[model samples]
Target chain A: MIPDDRKYTQEHEWVQVEGDAGVVGVTDHAASELGDIVYVDLPDVGAEFSAGDSVGSIESVKAVADLYIPVSGEIIEINEALDGDPALVNNSPMDDGWMFKVRLADPGELETLLDAAGYEDLLGK
Target chain B: MSDLKQTPLHQWHIDHGARMVEFAGFAMPVQYEGVLAEHATVRDAVGLFDITHMGEVFVEGPGAGAWLSGLITNSIIKGEPGKVTYTAMCNEQGGTLDDMLIYRLTEERWLVVMNASNHDKIVDWMQRHLPAEGVTMDDASDRTGLIAVQGPDSQDLVGRLEALAPHVAPIAELGFYTHIAVDGPGGEWIVSRTGYTGEHGYEIYLPAGAMLAAWEELLARGEDLGVRPIGLAARDTLRFEACYCLYGHELSEDWTPLEAGIGWAVKLKKKAGFIGRDALAAQKEAGIPRTLIGLEVEGGPIAREGCPVLAGDREVGHVTSGTFAPTLQKKLALALVEKDFAEADLMVEVRGKRLATRHRALPFLAARVKGDPRAERALS
Candidate 1:
C-alpha cells in the first residue's frame, strides 16, 4: 500500500515533500518482499545525487536490493539507528525506517513520481 | 523448458500461501510465514519440513554391504541393522559426488538418502558398478516422501502421532543415528533419529500416498506447541547454523571429505576399499590443500556464497555458504580456504568491500541432541 501524502517511485521508494525537502523511505510492499532487513547501506550526509541515481542498498536474509534516489537532491540526514538495528526496516519501514532526507534540487521533478492510485495500479500486476 | 516437478504436498503449500521457487527441478516452497520466524521456530520450539524432494535409493540383496562400502567413503560394514551413517559417495579422483545418509536396515539391505539434484547421477553411477548377479538398486525417490519433525520438543511431537503410539516409546529412546520400522495405517514406515539441523529430530520415511495424512496428523497434534510447516529457506539457515554440509555449497565435486572437515566419517583403514580410498588416504597423509572453516563477520553486510576469502591482500579461498545466522545473531559463513589461512583471522570481500572476519570453529551454534543427555545438559 502507498501513502496518499507521499509520491512513489517505480522502484518502490516513497518520497514525502515538505517544503524544498522530501523524506525518502521504501514502501511497505517493498519491505515485505525483502523479508527481514539485516543491513542498510546509506550514503554520507551532504552527498549529492541526480534523479534515479544509484544511492545505496538494502540487505535482507534472502537477498540484496539496490536503493535508488527518487528525485535529484542533496542528502541532509540519514537514519543512523539502522546501523545497530536494521529490523526497523521491516517493523516500521514507512516511519522510523525512513532511509534519509534530501533537499530537492528541482521541485518540478516531483511531478514525475507516481501517486497513491498509480502505485496501487502498479502493484496490482 | 518443461514444467517443474511438484511434491505431493504442493497443493497444501499453496493453500498455506507458501512462496514457491524452483529447487532441484521441483517447485519447492522457499518460505511460508517468513524466513526469520520459521528458522527461530525450529531453533527454540518445533517445526516440520516437507523434504519429499530428496531422493531415496534402496540397495539390497547379497553382498549389498560390501557393494555399498566400496562405493561410499564410510565404513559401512561396521554398522549394525537399523544404523544410520552419514557419508559421502565420492569419485575415484577423491571429489565428492554427494553426501548422503546410509541406513543399514539389515546385512543384506540398505537405504541411501541422496540429494534430489544428484539423484540421477548417483543412480547411474551405482548401476554402472553393479555386482554381477547379486545386488539390486532401486531409485524409490518418486514413491517415497520424507517429513522431518525437529527441535528440542521433537520427541514429544513424535510421541503425539496417534498411529505411532505402539512404536513411539522405542523411537523416543532410540540412540542417535538409529531407526525403527513402525507400522502406519497405510503401510510400514521407517522412523530414523537423524537430522540435518543440529536439533533433536526424526526423519519419517513413508509411502508417498501416506505422507499427506502423516503431515496433517503431526500438524494437528503439535498445534498447541507452536508447530509450523517450515520451508527450504529456513531449512538452509538451520543447517547452516549447525555447520552441516549442503550438497552444492560445502560438499561438491571440487572438494574432498577431508578438505571439508568431515574426515571422521571417512574410515581410511576400512578393508572394503571405497572408491576414493587411495586418493583420500594420500590426501590425508599429505594433508589436504584447502579446508573448510567457519567465519564470523564483524559488521552487517552478509557474506554469501562465492564471496572471496582474503588473507590480507592475497585471495586464499571462496565462501561456500554464508548468511546472517538467526540463532547466533551474527553474520556467519562457511568457506573453503587454503589450509594455511584456515586458522588465521581473515577478511572477506562482501559486495566489493573488505570486511574484517575471523575464522571460528565449525558449528556456529550448538546442537541439542536428545539421545546424548550430556550434550543436552551442555546445551542448557
Candidate 2:
C-alpha cells in the first residue's frame, strides 16, 4: 500500500510535496514493524536541518527508530496532535500521522527520492 | 537460520501470521497481532503461549530431593509432593547461574524446568555434580513441550479442557506453585499453577507430539472467550511489569538473587549445604552490595536496557530492564544500583539525554496470581 503521491526513502520515511513544502512521516510498513507506537519526539518548528540528518525519533513498545530528514529544509511545523496520542502514527501513517512539514531547501532534491513503484520494489512488495 | 531449532507450533504460528525471530537459538514467534495487543490480551483476557523452547530435566531416585536441595538456593526437601519451588542455581562465589522451577512429582521424582538459553550450561553443571549412585538426571527438553495460558480468565479457559477433566476439580482449586500430573494415553501431562506473567495462569507440560492438538483445542474452546496466541515480545513486557527476573537481564552471573530482589527464594539456614551457601550466607550477614529498584521516567523517551543510572553526576549502575509498561501506562525500569543509592534521587541517561526519574516500588502493577478464582467469579 505505498502511496503514489509521495516520494520515499530507503529508511522507510515518506515525504509528500505540497507547493514549496514537504510533509514527512514514516510509511505504513515502518509503523506496523514498530508495533504499537507509545511516544514520539519531534524537532522544534523553527529548526533547520540538512538532508539525511536525524530530526527526531519514534518510540514503540518494543523498539526505537530515528526519524531522518529526507530533504534538507527548515521545519515549518510539527504534528502537535501526536503529543496526545502516538497511536495515530500506527492507525493512519499516511494521513493524520504525518510528523512534520519542511520548507524545501532545493526542489531538485525531491527527484533523488524513490517513487511509489521504486519504494514498493525496495520493500519487496 | 537453517540451523535454528523450531518448536512443534512453529507452523501453527506462521499459519496465524506471527512474526518470527531467532531467540535462544530457536525460531520463535516474536509477535502475532502485536506486542501491546497480545500483552493486553494476557492481562485482560486469556492468551496462549507456546513455550516449548524451555528446557526440562527429570531427576529421579531415592536421593532426588536431598540431592536437589544441596544444589539450589532454595530447599527442595521442605516442599511436599505436588508443590513447585522457584529457586536459583549458583556458582561457588554466589553468582546466579540460572533461575528455575522444581516440581516435586513424588517422593523420589522431581522435575526441573530451566530457561532454554541456559539449557546446556545447567545440564552440564548438574551432570558435573551428580552424586555417585542415587541421583539420575534425564534431560527431556527435546522431547517435552510447554504451553501456558495466562490472564484473569485463564482458569475458566483451562478448566474446560476434556483432557484435564479427571483432574479438573483439583486443578480448579490448585494453589499458586502447586501442580497435578496425570498419566494420559498421550503421556504424562504436568499442569502447574505457575507462570512468568503476573496474571492468574497455568503452565501445561506434555509430550512434544501432543502440543499441536492441545494448542488447537485451546484456541477452539477459547474462541468465544477472546483467547489469542501471545508472543515472546509480550512475554517480556508482561514479566517486566510483574517485576520478574529475566535470566540475561535482571538475573545474571554478575548479580546474585539477593541483588535481583528474589532473596526470598534463597535459604541459607536450610541445613543442606547448597553450592553457594557459605558465600551467600556471608553476603547475607555482611549485607547485599546492590539492590534492584524500580524507576518511573518523566518524559517520552524510554530508558531502555543498558542505559546508565546516575545519582547526580556519578554513575551508580545500569538499567537491567526498562520499557513502556502497557498496563501501568508509564515508563518504568528495573535498575540494580548500590543499595545506599536505591532510595536516592536518580536520573537515567537515555540516548544522550538525562531524564528525571523517581524511585518506584517493584511490580509496577499488583499481581492477581494469588487471588481466589471462585471468589473473584462470585464478586463479578
Best by lDDT: 2
Residue B207, model 2, lDDT: 91
TM-score of chain A of 1: 0.97
Put down candidate 1 lDDT per residue, B156-264, tens digits, no spaces: 8888988788887798678889998877867768999988789889999999899888899999999988999999989999999888899889898888988988888
Kindly provide the TM-score of model 2 when superposed on the true structure, using C-alpha atoms: 0.97
Off by over 4 Å in 2: B373-380
- Clash total of candidate 1: 0
Query: What's the residue-level lDDT of B193 in candidate 1?
Result: 91
Task: Note each model's CA RMSD in angstroms.
Answer: 1.7, 2.1
Query: Chain A TM-score of each model, in the order shown?
Result: 0.97, 0.98
Q: Which whole-number lDDT from 0 to 100 does residue B232 have in model 2? A: 96
